[model samples]
Target: MPKKTDRHRPEPTSHTEPDLAKAKAVSIACGRRRFLIGLGALASAPLWPALRSAEAKAPAAAHWPGYADAMVIDALGGPGEYAAEPYAALSDKALADVRASGLSAVNVTVSGVGSYAKNPDETIRNIAYWNAQIAAHPDRLMLVRTAEQLALAKASGRLGLIYGFQDATPIGEDLDQVERFDQFGVRVFQLTYNRRNLVGDGCLEPGNAGLSRFGYALVEKLNEQRLLIDLAHGGERTTREAIARSNGPVAISHTGCAALAALPRNKTDTELRELAAKGGVAGIYLMPFLRIKGQPTADDLIAHIEHAINVCGEDHVGIGSDGTLSPIDFNDEFRRKHAADVADRRARGISAPGEEPDVYTFLPDLNSADRLDTLAGLLARRGHSDARIAKILGGNFARLFATAWSPA
Candidate 1:
């Protein structure tokens, strides 16, 4: 996620909600005007839609016997278009895709990352945009604050959207912002993105400096408030230290096993073991980081999942496909845009080693609305029991979320 410069921002439309009255008027009404303008521009690139081939077909959904009764959750994903256009109403296709996804809940990111995320006001506006979405589509969506709400969403057949941050820049130097954002219904907070921040070094930081004094305080505050602490992109020392220090279990929301593919973005076995030992969960992502040199296939994804299960046990492993629900339509225009997007990330210094122009972020063979179900069948064929598949799907993460959000 590169910084959102003015030139790259989209023009403000009527749905941009320039007026604070339209937004859930909060303590930060002072920056309401700037927030709306920034959000209008920020909405253009919610989460980068990495290119995928139009010719690539999704696997036909197989019959997973217990899939219907299972409560599925994408620990680190979006409603797809909810990230793309939160300010505007969701498109018919976007709505249809999410409803068809069979997703019980998704921990959708609602804050900026990288240098552009320095402003707390921008995060506030992102939260407002999501709130507006839930209000607009009450029948289809709900903001998940507690574990009970997650179950309710599944029981009601609605997609519960949980607010989370991929980076902690929005917290800034003020420790109070932790609880402040928590009151706004933010449930999960990641210490860093892919580089250094106030808390500590990210996975890309060569120094590998562990948590700072402020970072330690942030952990305590997060624990006291009962918010889920995510160590997905933290450096080695940071991840290990946070896992040791937190009062409750934390989550490495989306990543691959570094033993299979030694990428900085993927977690090491030591980290995974430590995370699981502390009652934490590790979510394997469907990103290019799963393989070192080529586009990751379904087997490559399964290998990482199997490795994680061996290292952390079935209860600790789950799916966290960083990609959106809708598969990318890699037409000529999309390819052009994809190239430019990669170039921009390279220029901004946020691009990782595996992020090549040709390597898409999702698994091609398994790309579809019913991807989780398809994965279940693949595991079932591997002799994974129905109970094991259920835990890997969402049961484990659901339990972890409930514990993290529970009172101290």
Candidate 2:
């Protein structure tokens, strides 16, 4: 197995830096130089064909419209609590592993509860790290904030990096930080993690008070910024309230439907319907808690997706593996040590009227993280049309992005 290392950290060299410095220096030398150059370019129009050809030369396989993934964690490699290897350290084999999974894009959540820095310099360094990794694979990866950008990345045979936050705590008590992140190309924002924050309560909170006043304001601001709101770890009331309150679609980036596996983390049929009714997508997660007890087969996951589709319709269904790069078995000692911290908030309260029995173990055949390809193949065998399968696989997510992200 690959091990994590800091040596693979991304850093910009003089060669790769954008020409901002040069532009600034030239501006001091002559203000009219840049403006005249722009006017001259408009007059000549010679560069238009080159730009068009460059776009046209993008790989054809990359242009598959229905090919988009809702959520994919960088577990085998990438920055996260679960991963052993840094994203930049990934070898060609690792990259191939992702491509082989049939994923055209992934939302890489770089900021999480543990990733926040106390000092400004450290924050800058962390942001720089992410930018460098993105620059390293410009042909294979591109930062995307809107649906159009994702399509462009797909057309270019590049993985789309939808920078996301797993916790709003990092934004601290200030809404300015959220605005700042929006400006920085963050496309998705989760209001809370597993614990309560200033904005709202998490799923683990004993009382599900829904959104706080600040939380409501945050939602409006997020909407104004055109960022996709995610209710992954939010409490039930909070999730529902957010869906009701938002002007645009919201996402449960990685989760299961309660109808399949009764868990606090899973959405009820009603919630799923509401989400889809509002033009949102519900990502069917592959986490252990999301599956039925015992080793969950790939079929088990498909069942959940199928159920969600029945309730939410085709355009509202997608995949969110919630996969981690962590090598420790979920049953290992480390998990036990963290057991109290990992308790499901939904599990604490009296079971809802129709909650299914809790599942402690997972399916045998779907034990590992590399079974996405198998799942896709299974979907094909189940008589799902290519177009429908494509939506379930990634198209639904693409549509959601089109609605949520706005460059204007």
Candidate 3:
């Protein structure tokens, strides 16, 4: 398992040098106790075992001194976690947990499901909401606009909130809005959600229409602005064309390997490899698309990672999770609410095909306050070298961000 070191554990000076295993360890048993006394609910995080609960929890390795220390970046988080409406701001408890979660930076969608109709108002208001949140909790969270800022977030022990969009609907016919949004600190933008837009068809659209003429123009505008282009829920034609047409690297921020479980949302081997060859990265999510049947397990998550690495090369794959940091409560009440929500999504033509009655939103074993730490431990156990694990955790994403955010 990935072990914890003291918060004082020094970070590695070079990416290609020694791995995290070489970090110094602190052995004061009471130190753990004193720390937990201050943590309150975070001490009893969902999967904290009974036997280990007695021992004072060590400052998590995933917190900053281990693999998570090397510029950890989640390509994107799942939906329903980043809504701007109801004026969601990081609560004190949520802030505390995020501080302890060990992430350097993560992409949070501020736009509603990628529609032009929702673009200016919904997205602008969402940005305003995050503005308020950042202003309120300046110590715990900050907006990340560049790769240097991503590294700074890691060293500063704060979570870098990256604004992203799941769809390109916000720009509408006016491509100028792309540059305007970039000026607004929106860094990552996906081409589509689950349906067609003016740019092109989504993965679920039966027509499979490729990138439009305007779509090509938009890609150039996005490239010109140095904003990262993402092709997550885009159709096969759109995915291929966008990757081929972009002047620089483009990302598939959250996806699965169709070679493992043939879901519409998952990418074929060609898409994975091509994106990697072009210097882009693909992040495998911890969702139902990883399995063909039943709930996904950690084993399933590992398999997808391995497959993505095999196809996309180790440098081009990372964990997007596509899940919230919040633990999913699978009680009857939640299940009922989620079911109704899923049904409503389908009725509205937003639900993807793989989402079913029992297909869980997150993996059971990975459901916890320290899911990122747990993921690093799981990857370590599977024989991934710390260097490779570092890339999988966030190195690749950071490299892409550096390139995309390069000054024009």
Candidate 4:
């Protein structure tokens, strides 16, 4: 990753760095310069001194009291206003609802892997786009790089957003690109999407080839930079090998338990056990993969979480809801757009097994901004202790981030 530097210093040299000057003349023409500026400004912000919130120690309320104090995080998700285009600026109401979600931080996927899999330039632009979003709403959003910032965000009531990649394509063939992205405030990278990449085989790959030599090198590079490695969509063998090879804890940022759902996107019991044994985290996603058919309810989600906790232990399990904070509108237009997007992914051979046009992503039962809090209430009623609930909500991921991104 890019070494820490003084804010006044010129940015380091890279493939894109030399072109930054040329980018300025055409800033109005293409917005590349603006992206560079946004990324620099966001990444250069001071790191918060490590600290803890007293809210965590406060007495629990009769009904879902720990949520206000707990550092709720979505390991893999988005800030949604349901824009037609990707990375479009969120709407005012969307921003309001995002705050209402009561989440301390969210690891948002800035780069996609399906269609844009091999497009490094698009990944760079996506990072810049999110930086601009954070810049535009500085009061409501802050770029996160450490656990201290997560605590600070919760204490101050601002949403902390962490940049992440759902695939390693953004880094291209060169390992130095990993450092380039780290300079842009990206902290998490998944080895592959649902299909094969240069790094490794994805879950959908029939061959189930393990991590490539490049994949191993990339894991080492990520460890050297203290960036979190994610194996969410990796093939079973690839997931095992990467987890065993990584020097530090990795994440399955968003997935379901195969024992419960038996889907390609879901991790097997052995994968979950291996992850927990290595101090890693397994984030149970709130997606259609949690079930075999029809819509998955809050009960289904709770069952998956419970099963994960049983297999991986509570400290190694958390939520990485693949859904957005803003509730989806099931209006006719949204349905049409959803169908088209699913079709496109299917055409590209990137869509997962459970991704049907009618199967909505988010749980209709927990379909509000305050879904996490609602989840905590449900867990609490189910006899889960406040401590366990807190860990599942966000503590585990926070601990993982602190451990993996330390000495930064």
Output the TM-score of candidate 1. Answer: 0.84
TM-score of 4: 0.83
Candidate 3 lDDT by residue in tens digits, 1-408 = 001111111222243233434322222322442333233223212323431454323643222237545767788872223222377666555676676567788898887774566567998998898878888877888899988888888888888989998888888889998888888899998988889988898999899998999899999989988999999998889999999999899999988888777778888888888898899999888887776655665656677788777777889999888877666655666667667767888887878877876566776556665776767754554445678888888989999999999987
Sort every candidate by TM-score, greatest first: 1, 4, 3, 2
For model 4, residues 1-408, the per-residue Cα lDDT tens digits are: 001111212222232132445434333432322232233233211211110122123233223778888989999887875544676788887899888899999998877575445567778788788889888998899889887887888888888999999888877789998888899889999889989888999999999999999999999889999999999999999999999999888999999888777779999989999999989998888787877766665667777888888788889999999877888765668768877878988898889998888766766556678888877766665557778899999999999999999984
What are the per-residue Cα lDDT tens digits for candidate 2 across 245-348? 99989888887777666656677777788888889988876555444343333445666777777778778888776653222243344334344323532353
Off by over 4 Å in 1: 1-59, 81-86, 116-118
Best by TM-score: 1
lDDT values for all models: 0.78, 0.59, 0.74, 0.78
Pick out the ten consecutive residues of candidate 2 with the lowest summed lDDT: 1-10
- Cα deviation of 384, candidate 3, in Å: 0.9
**What pairs collide in candidate 2?**
4-84, 68-394, 75-325, 82-326, 294-362, 295-362, 295-363, 295-364, 296-362, 296-363
Question: Pairing residues by index, what is the TM-score of model 3?
Answer: 0.83
